[model samples]
Target: MPYRISRLGLVEIRSLDLDRDLDYYLNVLGLQLTAREGKTAYLKGWDERHAYSFALTESDRAGMVRMAFRTVDPEDLDYYEKRLKDFGIKYDIIPEDYRRGRALRFTAPSGHTVELYNEMDYTGNVLPTVNPGPWPEGLRGIAPPRLDHTLVTAPEPGKAIEFFQTVLEFRLSEMLVAPDGTIIAAWLWQRPAPHDLAIVPGKPGGFHHAAFVVDSADALFRAADILAMHKARIDYGPGRHGITRGTTIYFFDPSGNRLETFGGYTAYQMDPDSRAIRWTQDQIGPAVFYYSQELNETFLSVYT
Candidate 1:
C-alpha cells in the first residue's frame, strides 16, 4: 500500500520556564504566538498554514510531551486503527481540541507518545494569497519558513524504526550501522524531505531536537549570527552534514530543549525501490558533522 502518513504536523514540548521559552520562540526563533490556553502556548512559522505547528506547555521538567503527524486523508486514520490493532498496539481516540481535530494517540515502541491526525484549522500564511510579497515585513530573529523535521531517541532504535516503517509506512532514507550490524541511528521519511523523523539510541522518551527550515545557506549563516546576538547556547553547526547534506545550527532554548535551524538538504521521494544511504560506525564523525569531522560531547549527551 502507498504511504498514508503525509508529514509532521505538530510537536508539543514541555518547558520548565514557559515565559522565558515563549519569549525565545517569539523574538529569537521568530515564531508567531497563535494562542494560549492555560499554561499551553501554540505557535507557528510565518509560512505555515496550520493554526499552529509547535506547542509549549508549562511543566516542572523539560521534555517532549508528544509529536503528531498528519495523514493524507481523514479516512486514513481508520486504516491506521486497523494496523495498530493488528500489531497489538494500544491507542486512544482524542477528541477535537483547540484548532486540531480528533486524533489517534499511541505510545510507540520507543516510549514516545505519537499522535496521528487529519485535520487542523487553516489560518493562512502571513501574506495574502494573491500578489504576495517575497516575505512579510517586521519579521524578527531568524524567522524560518516552517518546522522541518524532528529527531528523538530510543534505547533500541531498530525497534522504533520497525514501528515507523511497518505501521506508518515511513521509508528509510539513511542509517548508521555498527560493525556487528546493529543499527545505531535511522532516518525515516514519509514526505519528500530526507527525513521527517529520525531515531537514535538514547534514553527512552528523549528528544534530540526539532529542526526548522530556513530559505538558503546564507539564511543559515544569518541564523547563526542572530543566535549569537541573543547569546543563546549554540550546541553545534553553521556546518554541513554528510548524511543529508544539510546546513544546520543547533542551539538550546531557555528550558534546555535543543532546537535546530536547518536547510539545503537533498529531498528523498517516496519510492519503494530507493536504497537507503548507510554510514558505518567507523565514519561516524564525518557522517554526522561533515565540516568538523567529529561529534561534540553535548550533541549526543545533552537532550531533553
Candidate 2:
C-alpha cells in the first residue's frame, strides 16, 4: 500500500430540517455545536480532537452527502491523487476550510462521494492534556466518544470492496457471501477495529446508517431511554450483533435517516497474513441480530 487511512473522519449529512436535526444531534446525541458556516452546521463529540466531525446540510431529502477519512501522512493526498488518476477516477482538490484544511473529494464505485484528507482544525477534547479523567462532566444523552463506522448501500459490493481494498488500502474484516460466492456485504477497515466502513447490498448511492460507538452495552440501553423520551423512531437493536459481536441499537433521526449507537465488539487484529471471516447468505439474519436470529424486513429494506 502507498499510504494508510488513519481513521473514519467527518460524515456530511443531508437533512430536511437542518435545525431540527441539529437540535437532536446536539441535545440528544450529545455532540457539541461547533459552528454554523453558510448552510452547513458542524458538530463534534466531546472527545473528538478535530474541530468538528459531523456536518448537516439542509436538503429536500434525508441521506448522506459524503463520508471522509484521514490519512496517516499529510502528504498522502498527493499520493492518492496519482493513484486515483491511474485508476481513471476523476477527483478535485478542495483547499482550506472548505470542509477542513484541504481535501480530495471524489466519487467512488459505489456511487457515493468520498473524501480523503489529512487536515482538520484541531479542537481539544475539553480535558486537560495531563491526567485527563475517563470522561468529561455534564455529558448529555448517548454521548459517544467518536464516530466508529458507517454502513452504506451499494449495488455492487464486490466492486466497492475492490476500490476500498486496492486503492484506499482498507482490509476486509468480514463479509456475507452468496451461494455462488458473490459478496453481498462486507466490512473493511485500516484501523484495528472490525470495520470503519461497510458496504451493504442495495440501490446504488443509498446510505443505510452511520454508527457511533459508545463505551459499553449499558450505553446502548441508556441511548434507548433517550430515544424513547424524545419519541424518536428506533428501527432495530438494543441487541447484539453476531457479525462483529457488538451491541447495537438502530434508530431514526428526526429526518428519518437511520443512526446506530453501538459498542463492544470482539477485537480484530490483522497482519499481512490475515484473512477475512465469511458467512453464507443463509445465516444473514442471525449474523446481524444475534438474539433474534432473523432479520426484520424493515432492517433489510430501509435506507436513505
Candidate 3:
C-alpha cells in the first residue's frame, strides 16, 4: 500500500460573523486569503501548496463545517468509496473542479462530515520551489507555517477509531481508556506527523479545536503574545501537552471557536502492531497536561 492519506487538506469552519473570523484568520493567525465567494472566505497557510487550506463560512453557529483529507493516490478515493458502499456507509462522490478538487463526502460513524480528495490546484507556497529563501517578506501576526491537526468530539470514539484503523489505515498513537475498556480519547496518525486527527468523547457532530503548526516553542510563546495583543481570549497555556509533547497555546476567535498554536513535537510514523501509549483515566491529567496535573472543567465540557 502507498501513502493512502498524506495530510489534511482543508478545514471548512463555521463562524457567526465571517468578516470578523476572516480578519482574525488572516491578521492574527497569518493565513493568506486565497479567495472569497458569498459569505465564505478561503485561506491557506504560508507553506501549503493548495488553492485553499481553510474556509470560513458565515453561519449562526461556530463549529466545523467539514474537514478534508488529501490522499496520496486518486485510486484511493475509488477504493475507499467502494469500501464505504460495501460497508453500507452513505457517501457522495463529488467530481473535480467542484469543491476541493475531486472528493467523496461522507458522514463518519461519529456523525462528523468528512471528505477525501486526491487532487488540488498547485498553488505554490510563499517561497519558490527552487532556490528560495526561508520566509516571505513582512509575514503578519503569528505566521504559523502550516495547519497541523484537528481534534473533534466523537460520542463513540471507539467506533470512529476502529473505522479509521481498519478502513482508513490510520494508526493509533495514543489513547486514554476507561477501566471498562472504553476509549475516552484517541490520537490517530496517517503519516508525516504524530497525529493528524484526535477524537475526544463528546456529543456526536461536535467540534473541539483545530491547530496550526509553528516553527518552534518560541513561536508558540510569540503566538500567545499576539493573542494578548489582539485581545483574543486566552483559553489555556503557554505550556505543553504531555500526549504529543508539543508546546501549545489555546485561544478563542471572535466567534468563540477554539484554535491552537503548536510546535515542538517529535513526529512519529506508526507501523502495524506498533505499541500505543495508553493512559488510564486516573492519570489523564498528566496524559493531557504534564505540568498542571489537572484539567479545567471547560476542557472536558466545551465543544461546538
Q: Which stretches of candidate 3 lie over 4 Å from their true place?
A: 97-99, 265-273
Q: How many clashes (backbone atoms < 3 Å, residues ≥3 apart in a chain or on different chains) does model 2 have?
A: 0
Pull out the clashing pairs in model 3. none
TM-scores of all predicted structures: 0.97, 0.95, 0.95
Order of the predicted models by lDDT, top scorer first: 1, 2, 3
lDDT of 2 by residue, 101-157 (tens): 788889889999999999887768878889999888888887888888889988887
Q: Is candidate 1 or candidate 2 better by TM-score?
A: 1
Write the number of the candidate with greater lDDT, choosing between 1 and 3.
1
- Please write out the lDDT profile of model 3 over residues 1-304, one tens digit for every residue: 4557888887888999888788888899889888889988988889888788788889999889998998888898888888887788778877874345778989988888899998898888989899999889888998887888899988788898888777777887899999998877899887756788899888887888888887576677788889999999988888778787777788887888888887735344467556678889998887777779888778878778
Order of quality (TM-score): 1, 2, 3
RMSD (CA, Å), candidate 3 to true, equals 1.6
